[model samples]
Target: MTDFPQKARAAEAAMRAVFDATPLMRNDHLSGLHGADIWLKREDLTPVRSYKIRGAFNAMRKVLDADPSQDVFVCASAGNHAQGVAWNCRHFGTRGVIFMPVTTPQQKIDKTRMFGGDHVEVRLVGDYFDQTLAAAQDHCAEVGAHFLSPFDDEDVIEGQASVAVEMLAQMDGAPDVVILPVGGGGLSAGVLSYFRDVSPETEFWFVEPEGGASLTAALAAGAPVTLPKVDTFVDGASVARIGARTFARLSGVPRERVLLAPEDRICVTILSVLNVEGIVLEPAGALAVDVLEALRPQIAGKRVVCVTSGGNFDFERLPEVKERAQRFAGLKKYFLLRLPQRPGALRDFLDMLGPDDDIARFEYLKKSARNFGTVLIGIETKDAAAFPALFAKMDAAGFAYRDITSDETVAEFVL
Candidate 1:
């Protein structure tokens, strides 16, 4: 059996030829807030803006070293992994065929092309990831090309372990706790395995987006299980199933240590870091920081490290991000209101609003009858507490309204 630590260190050394180690910087803002010395392993600073490049590079390196004539590589991904593989493929002068879902954003596709140049060819396949993956695998077998998994293979896992290999070298001392964002379990499994051998005393927290928590589900079932459905808002770390090879390494991790980050709450963290810290982070990249408030009690007075996984955010989603953040902070709300058609009806309802309330959106849906109409209203308040007072005033004034801010079905169509 191979010693993972030794192989990971070797991989780390090999990666220097392609790109330097990403920064491990202390975050004073997070530290002050948590009353802990918080450091961020900035994997977002990599050449491909993700730790994924390390695995892709290492995996390809091993294959090429074993067989000099092999030059073809294949992978299926819509985001960071595609960029990583594309960038690494160009670095090694290898031919790559990347399969991406048809619905993948053009921003990601263009970036992948920019990274690979002439070294790679991208194929748009199925609309869903599963169909795309199947098409890629089938093509790989047909063409006799090496299939590089996002997280499942041994070499890929070993490549990801290089993250810990770099972190241990960069940190002054052993961190009291390490928080990682989990998707298909490649990075977490590799880091955990490396730390298990080297820094055995370090506590670990694995965070996953609430809507796609394969690791948490796997821990409960004692094996990897496919989720019936997954919300792909956090596209980078929203895997329906944890990779079997990666899960084999992660299976023993305690279920309690796996934290679930709500999609809306992640948007709040994304906005905070971007506005306050001037850091642009994707939903998965912000997962570790999003969980800090929840773990504040345990993290105080301890040295902690949060791995900011990737920074491949599409600026086009900025409006949606702001909307979700505001909603989560309770500063924005949508409601369906029944308003009487009398001349003073709107004036009376407007008077019910607090001083800080602002009507951001207002649209009359339909006249339910000659007396009243249905109105879709979006309100923005200076403080979350303002809603309670505003609601109380509305109640006293005999106004009829239903808060639809949390109604997914209505939000999907109206919000």
Candidate 2:
């Protein structure tokens, strides 16, 4: 029987041929905030800017070693995993076909192509990921190419265990708690499995994006269940379903240990880390850090390690991230107002603004009725509590308005 921990150590050793171990650095800022010794497993520093490369490289390495002539590989990914497979294909001088959803960002598509160079052919497929995955699988069967499962396969899980191996070797002392971000559960399962045997004393906290709480749902059903919908904002970790193989390892975990991070709140963490520490974290990558405050009581006065999963952030999304952060912080809001069509109505509303409240957006939507006009407005305030006072003032003045910031349909179209 293969000693799993020993196998993990061997995997770690083999990974050195592809890329050096990612840094496990003490985060003094986080330690101060949580009153604990906090560290970050910087998987963002890897060649593909994510730890997906670790599993991709390990799985490919074993396959190639077994049969050198087997050089064709296939995968479906909208981001990190595609880049991982692409980079390894080039490194190993193999051919790879990567299928990605048509909605994938151009930046991610470009990065994958750059990493793969001449060795990888990227196929833009269906609007949804499931279709893309099916296309990739069908292509693999037709072309006799090996299909690489992002997290389901045994070899990939074994490959991911290298993260636990490195964490144990890098940390100065045993960690009281280890926080992990979950998507399809590749990294979480691997890390948990390794620690279960090697560092049984360490407590685990697993976080998933609230919109894609596949792990939490799986735990609730005691089986893998698909989320009806997922917010793609946290693209890196927003999987609709947890992998069956990964869930096998994670099923025994207590449901309470699994936390869900709100999508907007994750944006706040992303902006905070970037502004405060100059760490550019993608939304999904910030999952572990975003939940630190909730776990403060348990982690206080103890050693904690939070894995900063990835950093493949596109600068184009900065505005959206900042906007989400502002909304989550209660600093920004959108509203629909009923305005009198009279010439002085706009001036009267502007006069009601407080010293700290500023108009961010103002537009007349319709004025079909001569007496009243439909207006769209956005307001920004210095503090969240200021909203109540502003609303009260508007109410007293008989200014009719509906807060549309939380209205999904209206916000999607107007805001």
Candidate 3:
């Protein structure tokens, strides 16, 4: 047997002591739509509500076993990783110091504390994760604490490999295609390594949020490279660079096999799972599901596993998520329209709206023009098809407007 496969088997055996494998459920909605067996590896149901706990548990276990006196462990994470480390610390009766970005949401911090209990100490460091990471490493060195890499360590990789171990067993063998989410690459790297040895028949497809595709960049450069900027909207997986150790294992993956899911599309999937299935998933957690449309052709008639990585969502972000989902699904739009100063102008435009269209917002922007004034309006419609007809009517009536729904600046300032 391959060494990696052996490691995965060992890890899976140890994992049973903590929690049974997360369910691998065949989703009818997805299967019917895609014409394939679409199974979800529900990593979101882990003890810490994510797969991170596996890596955290395995890494700490190995370290403590090697040196029984190693009691202090330190890690940097803004979300799931922090909670994982905290939970593992409590499980092992060891003390852990977690560093998180100061901007982390209160809900995440509270959850981390709840998991760690008296075993973990939470430190809010820099505004950005990089700075917080640096502070954590420095603190770890100063205090002689074991620095636990969330995704870059060998033991952690072994722990993450447990996911594939459970997956293989749960599927009664191996899936034809395994769809994984790529963040820092630890989970994917470990799981892929295990599958490579035990289930060589399995094919891999990786998904990353479009604005934070560090793995795609690494594959393109043939080395890990930092993104100048990343959209943190998908907080759990919005990594700027792939972990070096994790990337070393992931480097062999074909560049085309790694795809980027649009950030907005991910939001839509989050809403779908939440509203339709009563499953609460964070934006990063839903990346794999959002790519089903792109994978439909290749996955048709095949058994595919989509890793729903984490569910540490904050209800406070619900409004923003719904807003993003609506915009992405073409159910909402914002436009700046020029309206004639004549009294009947607004009435004529209102008469043009379709039965399904609703005026969500209307505000006059400028009144300086002699014949017309600038008006900002937001419209929500039952169908995207309504926009074309509405635009045609506007054109025929000589209305001037600028669609600003997708304009980042406009969205931030006015929308």
Which candidate has the highest lDDT of all? Answer: 1
Taking the tens digit of each residue's C-alpha lDDT, what string does model 3 give over 1-415?
5688887778779878878889999999889988998999998999888999999888888898899999999999999989999998998999999999999889889999999999999999999888999999999879999999888899999999998888878767678999999999999999998887777889999999999999999999999999999999888888999999999999999999999998888988998888878887888889999999998889989999999999988888888888788899999999999998998999999999999999999999874657889999999999999998999999999999999999999878987
Across residues 211-269, which tens digit of lDDT does each residue of candidate 1 receive?
A: 99999999999999999999999999999999999999999898999999999999999
All candidates' TM-scores?
0.98, 0.98, 0.97
Tens digits of per-residue lDDT, candidate 2, 86-162, equal: 99999999999999999999999999999999999999999999999999999999989999998887778889889
- Order of candidate numbers by TM-score, starting with the best: 1, 2, 3
> What local lDDT does model 1 show for residue 352?
78
Which portions of model 2 miss their true places by more than 4 Å? Answer: none
Residue 200, candidate 2: how far off, in angstroms?
0.7
In model 1, what is the error at residue 337, expressed in angstroms?
A: 0.4
In terms of TM-score, how similar is model 3 to the real structure? 0.97
Error of 2 at 279 (Å): 0.6
Better of 1 and 2 by lDDT: 1
Model 2: weakest 10-residue lDDT segment is: 1-10
